[model samples]
Target chain A: MNIIVCIKQVPNTTQVRINPETNTLIREGVESVINPFDTYAIEEGVRIKDKTGGKVTVVTMGPPQAEDALREAISLGCDEAILVSDRKFAGSDTWATSYTLSQTIRKIKDYDIIICGKQASDGDTAQVGPGISAHLDIPQVTYVRKIEEISAGHAKVERLTEEGYEIIESKLPLVITVVKEINEPRMPSLKGKMRAKNAQVLKWNADDIECNVNDIGLNGSPTRVIKIFTPPPRKGGEILKGDTHEVVAKAADLLKNVIIG
Target chain B: MVDYLLTEEQKMIKELCHKIALEKIKPVAAEYDEKEEFPWPIVKILADSDVCGVYIPEQYGGMGAGIMGMAIATEELSWGCGGIALAFAATGLGTFPILLFGNDEQKKKYLPVIASGKKLAAFALTEAEAGSDAGSIKTTAKKDGDYYILNGTKQWITNGGEADIYSVVAITDKTKGARGATAFIVEKGTKGLEFGKKEKKLGIRASATREVIFTDCRVHKDNILSREGMGFIVAMKTFDSSRPGVAAQAVGIAQRALDEATAYAHQRKQFGQAISSFQGIQFMLADMATQVESARALVYSAARMIDAGSKDIAKVSAMCKLLASDTAMKVTTDAVQIFGGYGYMREYPVEKLMRDAKITQIYEGTNQIQRSVIAMNLIKELAKNK
Candidate 1:
């Protein structure tokens, strides 16, 4: 079993602060951390590899600093890591991002499973995982709470739903977007940290993955954010004072007057 | 650019320790302090997390992040609970003698068990007669055939009864004075070895402190660390290497106090405005934050020097410990002042932090001892120049 996990680097929410004057994020002192949801995905991929006896590879798409996320994944028992980074990939929307990731997977050419977090916390857009599956033409499961079982040719999982969960069985070569309920991510062991320190991360740019320049970055993105603003603060409501009967009478009178007006 | 930034690995270690401290240790800290319990649950978490193994070498199944890593972890954990932090930090204190002086066989036999967190280790040098003067400890190890008989007692030994391995200093030759003392690896279950009274302490109650009594305790001759009569050397070397960890603990305590005071000052109100608006309170907070940052800088620099394999680190290590612990004491007291009446109550965190801050000044050689060590080294350096 060869498992590949996709992870993302996001600003630590605890430390993020907004600049009031510019209405933009104050990123100067903010620290970057692996997306909390992606931790579970990495853990699930590593767990599958541990049980089935194969390698776990972690991949991420961002700037050069995103290598930290991949190395962190490697520290948690991933056998290999890849950084898919290029200036061309900047500002790519969910579709373009998924396409780029699928192209990288196609280049790797041998993977039994692809795991990802249901959503990136910063974007809250849960489309990338399913989008990757759509691009790869592989079976995909979203909101997986648990991996019930995985055998030679099939995988069983508990897919979360509004009403409890549903046990879904899918064939091999599947993509899974895991929820936080999947597994607790383990800390890097002493040996694991040393291994991560020495492990070489394979870096792939747009040209390296044979990505089309026309379908990447802001030019390829279909959606654009024209404005971002905080909602207005809520005003206090009027209180109907006095006894219940009197309050009801006054409220009724006000409602009738407003309706008539 | 003279950058004082932590390495990527050090940052990760700090983050891990901070998480564990907040999630695992903080909730239970007050309870343990109130009950004066030994904090076994926290010990279990530290062991399982490989926090206990931070200072050990890689071959022994440890992160081998050295003093800098240990200091970073110590600071973060101490921020949550100084008493609980001591439980983990003391293990490094115990294990350093072995790492610095233990021969191949000893390292192989002892380090793996400790690095795996299978057992705890302790350093016992202080006795009834010896406090700052460690050279006068009365414990004796008399060689007889294949074993050396150890007799006497160790007082105020941290992790005393709970530890499985002990690095004890004892007199091997009465005529040789301090040079006569030797360090030995005495297993906990050895016949005639027993734990004496457990001391009730004012602060850091979660950490265990007790007397270790050895009544004609038998020890294998092979357990001697380095060689005979190297006991003082081992003890001093271990302290030199570990003082930065203690300093880090102080920095953590001070930082915690500063954070609590700042948060409280902003929300607390007087004269229709937050007390934080007052210039008096602002100055106090400014002082607290400055001292905490200064201590952190000194502690990190000393730890980095040790990690860089600097031989002449005694002066800086002692200065770090002295300044940081003093800073902790002052900052915590001022935090209580900032909190006013509420800070006096145990329901709030500042009072607990204040209590915890007092011990950093007293332990790992008192702040007075640290100052002397620093001054003596300074005088010696001046003499060399003359």
Candidate 2:
């Protein structure tokens, strides 16, 4: 079986800042890292490969500098990596990003499984995985919390929900979008690091992946960012004070006023 | 002496240590290097994380980590910033002599705060006249009623200027040579003890080093380590246990070198193909890989021998230090070569790695002294074991 984990390189959130005047994020000086959430998808792919005999390949779409993220995934035990990077692909929104990723997945053509983080920290759309599934016309397993089983041609999965989890079986060539709670990521080992250092990063672009000009990248993006802005500041909560009995009576009085009013 | 292989919890330590090194150490390394400054922030990081006294006994409020666990954490942390790790290593190197041989009072008075990172410590042994030849130390600690007046200069002391506690070595008897050397724990800012300016180093800039001077510095008679005359043996014995740690640091350095070189080779191009695909570069890569593995085997072997009750540790420890340091120098040098012109520039990561690699050879008993240690210890072991 072949598993492809779609990872994203997001501007490291720790260094990010919001412009006070313009209410936009400051992207400069922000380093890129594998979306903290994507790490679990790569880890799950490796775990599944470890259990069954197969290969784990990672694919990402971004600028040339994004290669670092791919190499990191390789270090985490992904057997192969590809950079779906190109100048023409710049400014792609979630719709275009998923379309590009789907094209690259199609180029691979031989994969039995595709996995991705449920959402990118920068985008938080949680739409790309399902979008790719829709683009590829394959049944998808979203928010997968566990892999129940995998056999000759099918995958048994347990997807998480608000109340509990549900087990579902999907046919071959399926897409799985994982949540952060699914499994803990593995530490990169000496051997895994060595492999990551030497692994080939096949760079594909819109043209190489055979994506139609109007169907991907900025042109294909149905949702333009227009202008990114920060959310408004939160207001302070009410203050309560005094000893236990007095505080409780005062709180009861406040609650009565809030509800009665 | 117990098994040193990592348990599940240790893997967590390893991951956390790596994260700290990359996140905290790398950014400031250049600033500290340029100014010859102490990275107080790194100390705060280590202290807040409560990882400083890795070897301190739990009863004394330490993690009480074994030698191997300490070695692993030290190795990973050293990779990101060797100087910072050196500053923290001073905690163990300076106090292990105390923890290993200190009386119950010493343990109760010192171990807890040192391990907790509340009080930084320094180990003073290399004197102006005595480095590898530690017996020739000229520092004198004359007995004075209830105290000992220490008069000596300790060379290249880690945390010399910033530490709260210092474990110093001085001569108590001239005629006895190595046997005359005595060890004492002198708290910093003592009336007679003063530190000189920091040393300008090629790398590990985030951690500071300096010369500590003692002008009639006085400590209570109880500050002596093991015994008055055994200071030389105790300091040397400390190295026997600590040399593997330096070797572990080299492993971290070499690992980073391999990482940078491998990443560069694949991305960098020559002729019509990726440089990594070319046979000539492949040979170099092969050599780099082999050197790292050899150094690792020697290092882990010495670490295991230390855990296995083998007196053979001194020789093996020296061998590991020599091999690993040498490998770090070579691998990092080649890593620069792999980067070609970019390796020479400061902006590139490999250049910093190259600079970082040089000191491993000079510090922790220069590779030359490591050879002497191995040769002498080997002769002694073979004569008995053979």
Top candidate on TM-score is: 1
**Residue A159, candidate 1: C-alpha displacement in angstroms:** 2.9
Provide chain B's TM-score, model 2.
0.94
Question: How well does chain B match by TM-score in each candidate?
Answer: 0.97, 0.94
Candidate 1 C-alpha lDDT tens digits along A1-261: 988999999999989898889777888878899999999999898889889999998999899999988888887889999999999998999988998999999998899899999999899999999999998999999999999999777999999999999999999899999999888787665457667889999999999888888778887788798987877879898998889999999999999998997
Encode model 1's per-residue lDDT on B1-386: one tens digit a residue: 12458777787688778888887788888999898888777777677667778888889878788999999999999998999898788888889989999999999999988887788888999998999888778889999998999999999999899888999999999999879989998889999789987799888889889999999999988999988899998999999999999999989989989999999999999999999999999999998888888888989889989999999999899999999999999999999999999999999988888888898888778888988998899899999999
Per-candidate DockQ values are 0.24, 0.02
Per-residue lDDT tens digits for candidate 2, residues B252-321, read 8888888888889999887988999988888988899889888877787787677666775788888988
| Error in Å for residue A122 of model 1 | 3.2
Segments in model 1 whose C-alpha atoms lie over 4 Å from true places: A16-32, A62-65, A85-93, A188-199, A205-261, B1-28, B31-54, B57-69, B133-138, B173-176, B194-199, B293-317, B371-386
DockQ of 1: 0.24
RMSD of each: 5.1, 18.3
- Clashing pairs for model 1 are none
